[model samples]
Target: MVVGSDGFWRLLYPIHHAETIRQAAEKNNLDPLLIASIIRVESKFRAENVSKVGAVGLMQLMPETADWIAKESDIPYRGTVDLSDPETNIHMGSWYITSLIKQFKGNRAAAIAAYNAGPGRVSRWINEGVWDGTFETSEKIPVGETRHYIQRVFFSYEKYQQLYPNF
Candidate 1:
């Protein structure tokens, strides 16, 4: 029998490092599915992944951003080396997500967009009434990459929640 589409998708989107993801998510009071989705979108579960722009590790954290997160969150951070470690990356990423969520006043879309485009730009768009900080009107976002990033992260987040409810 052919697997249903949901089952097929689940097979494709298996969660990795689930316990680490769960721990980081719980520490930050975030949904584990969200952290898993971000890791999927950012690094495709590749712990050593690094973006062209130098975002390091599974969370694709920029070195400068990671440094700031470490300082603000009081997490042990030595250098870019720390970002390559899956556990440290997850901890820092989760902390950054929580910080962004609070900064964006609990708007997950805005927070996710900020994660991709930087909070300053996202804040400007929101303050200028260019975007309402919701996925439904994402077109108003000036940066195409960030708009798409928000959509991708949200889509992955939904899929993870469906495929791994107990995660």
Candidate 2:
């Protein structure tokens, strides 16, 4: 298949909150492209986006999850955190993904899957031999949404790399 021009792809996969993404990723020792990919797949860079399940902001993080992340990551929180803020959401999301990567032993597929399906479920799948937590075996993951979510993040990540090589 012939891919679209870089300009066209850039138009479709625009990166918003670059500085915030960079800061969050760097602080968490993560690739900014990965964060951008997650944001694209999660909320398409829309800060006000909210999922049907109460996930909010560009990263579509749930309030409870954000609160947990803040506590774990030592981010400032006093019960009411505005997840709609790009900086806060990206930082928390980055930290959470970084933790997930560590929890899954750097298995990005599993980490990304856990980001969508929750760590407990992913761990259960791994422990039960339901899935091996590798990108190659992502198809074996029981949750279709998580499998598709990983695929989308990967696609967006590649496009971001291609369009913004220097980023």
Candidate 3:
């Protein structure tokens, strides 16, 4: 879905439980605003939104990743369509993001990139030590799309904080 500059909902998106998203993020020690912002950037909060690449739902989870998360988290195996549910999506996604953060030693940019680009890309960045302000280590961020994804999410993080000051 195409989101405008303002980031308002032009069409109804299925973010039914802001509190659930918040709780999952907090439980994982992630900034709730950051999670919310990523959802905004990733899928424009459109649950059931599928990417051309087959990432599904509000967080646009890939099928393999969704299966992995479900198995790892002991969440019941639902078909990919259940990803549209804010509560389930955020629960699994928040856990997965927390996993990435640990793997990257709390590097927000690296974890975020991994979330977008995949673990292999983030690992290369870690090894090469090439990075930008948007990245702490940039050696292996070869994919331009992942780079831009990181930038957009970081920008959205700030805006999310402003939109909901308490979050």
The C-alpha lDDT values of all candidates are 0.90, 0.89, 0.76
Q: lDDT tens string, model 1, 1-167?
A: 25778778877787888899889988999998998888888989999998889999999999999989977987888999989999999999999999999999999999999999999999999899999999999988899999888888989988887888776
Per-residue alpha-carbon lDDT of model 2 for 26-123, expressed as tens digits?
Answer: 89999999999999999989999988999998888888998888778876655434788788888889999999999989899999999999999999
- For model 2, what is the alpha-carbon lDDT of residue 109? 90
| Stretches of model 2 off by over 4 angstroms after superposition | 1-3, 79-81
TM-score of each: 0.95, 0.94, 0.82
The parts of candidate 3 lying over 4 Å away from their true place are: 1-16, 130-140
Q: After superposition, how far is residue 158 of candidate 2 from its true place, in Å?
A: 1.3
Model number with the top TM-score? 1
Off by over 4 Å in 1: 1-7
lDDT of 3 by residue, 1-167 (tens): 45653345323322446888878987788888778877888888778788999988778888899899987786665778778777788877888888888888877888889999897766876576655424543434678888778878887777666566775
Q: After superposition, how far is residue 152 of candidate 2 from its true place, in Å?
A: 0.7
- TM-score pick, better of 1 and 3: 1
145: Cα error in model 2, Å: 0.6
Error of 2 at 17 (Å): 0.5
